[model samples]
Target chain A: MKKRKLFILIEGVDDKRFFEKIIKPRISSVYCSINIDTSAQTGNEKIRRYVKSFHKMGADYIFVTDLDEKACITKKKNDIHRKFRVRQDNIIIVVKEIEGWYFAGLSGKDINKLGIRGIINANTITKEEFNRIIPKQYESRLAFLLEILENYNIRAGKRNNESFCYFMNKYVSP
Target chain B: MKINKLIVKNYKTFNNLNISLDQFNVIVGSNASGKSNFLSIFKFLKDISFSGLENAIQLHGGPEYIKNINTKGNKNLSIELNIDFDIQPRLVLSMKPDDQLKENERFEGLGMTFKELKYKFEISFNSSRKYKVINEDIKFKGDLSKLTVGESQKIKEDEFHKGSTITFSRDPSGKVTFKTGAIQHFIKSMKHTQLPILPMQFVKVKHTELFLLEKAQELGLSILPPIATTIQNISSYDFDCKASKTATPISVRNTLESDGSNLPIVLKRVLNNPDTKKQFYSLIRDCLPFIDSYKTRPLLDKSIMLEVKEIYQSQYLPSLLLSDGTISITAIIIALYFENNSLIILEEPERNVHPALVSKVIDFMKDVSETKQVIISTHNPEVVKYAGQENIVFISRNKKGNSIMTAPKNNEEIQVFLENELGIEELFIQNLLT
Candidate 1:
């Protein structure tokens, strides 16, 4: 049997790493036959173009982007869908930023290991808050983040973090 | 010698990459995608052979900087090259953390190590960051019947050695003996364990009593000679020639300098040789038609100043007065004409030049590649277009932030896009090549 091809477009190398190293390993059994085409982060314009082009080429994809301080998830999702002309279900907007999802997915112990203590809300974590906690470097911070996630066996799904899990369950898995 | 394959691991940006080479290779990537880092591999090898491993690492901003950041704790950075000589010989060199050398080893100056096996070679650093040759082997390409008695004994001893392979310096007269004059010559040639193996010039391979050296004029061992010649001839041009325009002291130079600061001297030398001068002028005229002529004038201080004459003007103006684009193009033309049967790695030839001239440069580079191997690192669409899909290696960072190298021929979507819809440049601009 031929596996269905699922294309994924994301904003940066970190997001791509999350999908490949973190999410893919955990869901391989369920999505056994599906082929995933994850693109290197080329920027927002290229991501928009790729989403449209991949759709036209007869491959379904999930366009992942940050909410970028947007007030409402619905508004961000609608804007992305209308702008890129992608299906509403195919768009996954990370609240505030992808770091927020990372914070949400990791347990209190894992968060403490990352040097953050007493974090009340992971979902509402802003980019600034994340940057304050773990500064960025020329080397992707995600390399370190993925290492932490792997050590704890923390899966990137709805149970750990809602937005990431939603995309995994709804689009990534068979 | 042409490199057929290259494998790099734990090097900057590259986690583990294997790239096949072509006569003319154009490497394109986004910023920080490791295009220049990839080209630096050639320079790195040349530097190691020329100035030993510690100096090479130090010159390149230390081991910490050269080693890939994403590599987990204590992983060794390695580069393996398969060069097509008489027979394909694979050379592997790995740099490991060197915090463990003994006090005596530390005091034993210029820490560098080299290990050689029949077709395999390894070099690593001791605990004190000093390099030492750990293993050396010599294996023949064909059947065991071809092996001399000494060569067979050496192989057997190598197979039985428990620890690391026998070091050539430490075991000068160990169990293994060899009849292959070249292998014995290489083993006996090592005067110190601290010296690097690749820099045959300093190591004095030419003076050795190897059979190949005795018959150097006739029989050619494709492997060693090409590796030596290519390493010696490897030239890198960053095209920063602003300092060359000034009236600098003139020194006789047969080859162009890396930064082109000696452009006047090299240009003078080229003009003196009629064959090279004609080709240089023709290339310049083709690439920059506005120029009537260029010459060097000796100043009172014995320094030489370059002068360029515009076609419309009768009086020649100083080279310092010319635009950056003209000087850059002229330097490139000179480099292309002078370097013969060598590998040239150029970084971002499109910088500071007009698009039309950039195309001319690419065309000239293509022409040069017929006689010599040329690898260019560029982000220009025109260069990528002119080089075509087959000659280009697209480099991108994988999800793990590791630099991955890919070619259009290996990419199905890129092939489909090239065949059906857009050109290579369009596909590149759309970021579809990844």
Candidate 2:
């Protein structure tokens, strides 16, 4: 008998985090024998490539992606299903928005009472500086970054912060 | 050519896992045993394979957002998909945050790599990762990398090339050349079709479902269309969708863009092209029996505004005159009327269409998929049922939130239970298993 495999996908870590922090601890036993994973798009060219692989797999698979940041994903997922002949239930997704992000900033009584920290952990301008391009809320990302730095433990010698500096380096001289 | 196997390590959902697929694999689990997340790997690898490590991180929002946080510390996420394309070609991709730090987007820089055994291709890079093309192999492969860097150099088998990596082909001559840019192009070919989706700040109210319908002609993995609608008027310019919100008539003009955004322009050109005007009338009649004969009288040609009338009632036009599905249908007709092999990817084809028309719309898609690959991403069972198992692909997430084709059981009990609960019909076995 083949060991059944499972694939879980998502747009960001929020989904992974929430499920791990909130969902998993609750339903630890019911879901088993499931080899699961999550991922998001790198970009378009790569998306097509993966779609091809999924089709070639010719087994049951699922694809979770957003809709309409550029155009609709309706066709892309469908194309994979048709080519691979996978089951419809295997292809699931949250429609146009990221389902987990909504859970990130969730407010009101439950949040305050639960002692849930805000998802955005870092607030430094360092994040935007690395993009070479920047979004308006660069400072806001600090809330998210601070959490990252705290958990990551950056060492001067052990840590090479190229990704931390890529966009920021654009404006600053070496 | 089916994927009967999968192995993953330190991925988003699984710490270490392996699984096999049934041809018609239906992954049914509680809301979040990593169902949706399990299915995300394909999208992730697709983004990376087709674009590169850099673009994949950006499209995914950021690298911090991608790395799995479970089990402590940073772990390299790896993926291997064994595919049988007549001959089995194994594609493995792996990545993690770059050791170097930058900014949020750039600070989220990652090291991504791809390995395809068929082509013996392997490419890897990070925020500062660059390829040092070997000179020896370049001569044998021909001007593959010359165009990328704009300079070429010579190096003996014993000598190393500066800024250039050395390549020694297996050919008898033992030629010396640098690596060709073929790796880049091969990776670039891995693209996001059916439009890539990024998490938005908000949810959409009237969100569209990208439904898969056959063009009734396409048979391959490609997304080409089966039929092309020939429009009589090519020079009519753009289309104007002047129909109102409450109750307005649909108007067609000279040309309509594939998205049907040009309905407004089509409304403007109705006066010049009688056939277009007639077609517009017929469409209104089919969609809105309340709409009688209507004419496009230019209120302002520069602004591209027109008046619509139905004998008893006359009103200024807006998109609201038609129901959401009616507009979509009109959009489909208008877009299809003039396009060729240009595959139309609809988001939620079931939306707005009456249940009666839903089946027809699907039939239309079935016809289209024959000539062109009509790929759709939908959760609606109706759409799924319409396209049949052969056209449906279920998506879910794993615990760590990586994507997978078949739902990961995490263990044996869940798999047995799912099979028992879902009743993997003998019919399903036929579709998914050989």
Candidate 3:
């Protein structure tokens, strides 16, 4: 069977890192090609053109964005629809931001290895909060992010964040 | 001095060629289409200055290889260069022991007040397998031969005769002559050795000699040494990553070799200077952001090695452990910052470099070209994109197998195509530009 081609629109470099290092391996067999556009959020005009072009080329695409400070998931989805003409079904909203997804994958033992403080809820963790909780032993934020990704626990990720679990159930199979 | 024009005849794949050059040039061509051969011309002149002509020819795979095989008869090779002096050169008087005292007492040296120079030379082989000079000339917009050092005060007060030609020629009979307006008086004042003529003893001047300019410098003539020195300063490189990884001896750190074997020592020189050191590290950050700092250490055997510290790593990684891309880029940066050549030729600078890093490297080369001439040969479209189509020189071959070069600035069709919003590389890859 010929595998389907899927394009994932991402906000920035951090999202690219998450998809490439953490999420790509689990969903590799589902798509013949998976192109993660890290700079998809650069402008609404470019994103609109990309969405239309990909649709015309007979390729499926999913737009992923953070629901930060929005009243609800519906408001975030509506915002993307108005800005880029993307459909609600095609938009996948993270609970707060992609940085929180890094924390969603950490197990109790993984947290111990990271030498960080206790986390109350991974889905509620914003980018700023994650920065504050990063261990001082790491020289750079990139180093800390890489260390977390190196030992990422996908099963724990689906169990911790509702949005993450929804995304995995719809797009990936265990 | 920057060479503004070059004319090559009966050399390699070039039957007859003339091209105008700008400060920055990016030459593109398929494999063996003459990009490297074009770059080798500058290297050939440089080699002729340091190692003599025969050795330079040997280094380039011998006389037969350099001469164009397509030439029917009298297989002679000729090169002509037109140089623009950024500033007028100050002439130094090299007088006889008896005249030295008179020069100091009576004359302060004069300047060769010219704005442009044209130097040309041709060579042919004799039956003995030795190269012989068939013709040579150096013409410039200055009159050095009109002034005699004995009457320097009078000559200085008198206005200089400008727009004159100094001609050095050798006929097919092997007779050499140096002629210009009022040159008889100038030749009368100088000794037999410094008369700008090859002596009877050197009648069979070996193939391993630059008979005109180098000989003038050797004989310490007042006008030609500075020009010869400028030609000798030309350097070209295709840096070898493996050579750069090895340790270099402490004594040989003067200039970065063509292969970049002495990169550690050259980098050390850059670090010693505060301004270049800052620029070097900042450029490195732009190219390889993960690298935080670098240092050099001496081996036990009086040699040195280079090591770099990654952004979050506590230990410094030796060059041997570093990636090929990292070392090659580092060597390029060192060459740009520390090497003091008037003209620098880089062959395939994009080799081993990731596509992400090409922009910074090209930008740096463009920036450096402001002070000196930079010529690069590459096949990468990203390089062509960043270098801009206006700076491109496209080389191809003809039915006769001779190389044909076309600069986009000189081609009307290429200019019209460049006006479009589409990238020039798109057209280049489609073979439309040809």
Q: What's candidate 1's i-RMS value?
A: 5.9
Interface RMSD after interface superposition, each candidate = 5.9, 13.9, 10.7
Ten-residue stretch with the least lDDT total in model 3 chain B: B191-200
Tens-digit per-residue lDDT, B331-407, candidate 2: 55544343442333344445456765665666656655444434344444455445554444444444455434443
Better of 1 and 2 by lDDT: 1
List model 1 lDDT by residue over B1-434, tens digit each: 45667877777788888889987899999899999889887887777656655567788777677778797765656666655443333322121123533432321121111222222223343345443333223322211111112323341111211112222111111122223323223233322232123322222222111222122223233432333344657788887868768875875564777788888888888888889778888888887888888899999998999999999999999988999888888888877767553778888877878876767788888888877778989888878777889899999887588998899988765665565445688677646567
* Comparison by lDDT, 2 against 3, better one: 3
DockQ of each: 0.05, 0.01, 0.02
Task: Give the clash total for candidate 1.
Answer: 23
Order the candidates by lDDT, highest first.
Answer: 3, 1, 2
- Candidate 1: list runs displaced more than 4 Å: A1-58, A62-174, B85-120, B136-226
Per-residue lDDT tens digits of candidate 3, residues B130-204? 677766667656645223355434644333445655565555554556565544444445431143333433443
> What's candidate 1's DockQ score?
0.05
TM-score of 3: 0.63
Give all TM-scores, in the order shown: 0.61, 0.34, 0.63
Which structure among the candidates has the greatest lDDT?
A: 3
